[model samples]
Target: MRIVATNPDQTQAVGKKLAALLQPGDLILLAGDLGAGKTTFTKGLALGLGIKRNIKSPTFTLIREYKEGRLPLYHMDVYRLEDGGAEDLGLEEYFNGDGVSVVEWASFIPEELPAEYLEIRLNKDETDDNKRYIDFNAQGKHYEKLVAKLAE
Candidate 1:
């Protein structure tokens, strides 16, 4: 599914909607360029999950955990692992554990990803700095349904 966000708020609204449909063990892969509002989207997710804490990018720390929400949130940024070594992080545990996992720059650790997951790509419009095209690509039946509900 393709979602057009005219501004940051709209993009974050999309994230809130998706967060409502998330279940334990859900894996969401976010692929986008810098300044694409990935972190902004996640802030909305945190709010939807009942997390009141600040939601920041995990770029430097690699992973940030928020357990105050209805479901724990494991936000990860593996961009720093571009050269390899993601295996040491035990990413599968988070992907398979209770609570949802949202991965940024997931392509860096393709081998660590589960077979079934949701991939979201944020493409910025060249002509409009604030516009973003959020593309959803489901990798499994469950994700397909999730995307359908999100579109609704």
Candidate 2:
């Protein structure tokens, strides 16, 4: 699905709707540039997941685990990862484990991703500062189910 978000809140709202469809062991690949409201969308997802703690970007820490929610949320930012560091950081464990993993700057660690996952791409529209074009692709049956759930 493709969505045009006029403001940060709209993007967050989309994230919140998507969050409701997630299940344990699901992987979300977030693709966007800096200041594309990726973190804001993540915060919304955390909120929908029933996470009450402050949600911060895991830029330096690489990953932030929030077990306070119904299902653990492993939020990761791999933007700072160097060659071979994405896998080295033990990201695969989170992807295969009993939690939902959302990876920001996911393009940097494409090789570590599974064949089936939800890829959310955020793009900036030069004509409108508040505008973002988000493209979502469901890669497998798992994601297809998510898309179906989101449509509800």
Per-model CA lDDT versus the true structure: 0.94, 0.87
> Could you tell me every candidate's TM-score relative to the true structure?
0.98, 0.93
Worst 10 residues of 1 by lDDT: 36-45
Candidate 1 wrongly placed segments (more than 4 Å): none
How many clashes (backbone N, Cα, C below 3 Å) per candidate? Answer: 0, 0
lDDT of 2 at 26: 94
Clash count in backbone of candidate 1: 0
Tell how far residue 91 is off in model 1, in angstroms.
0.7
lDDT of 2: 0.87
Question: Quick one: best TM-score, which candidate?
Answer: 1
lDDT of 2 by residue, 1-152 (tens): 78899998898898888878788899998888898888888888988888999999999899999998878899999888746577577877898998889999887787888899998899989989899998888999879888877767
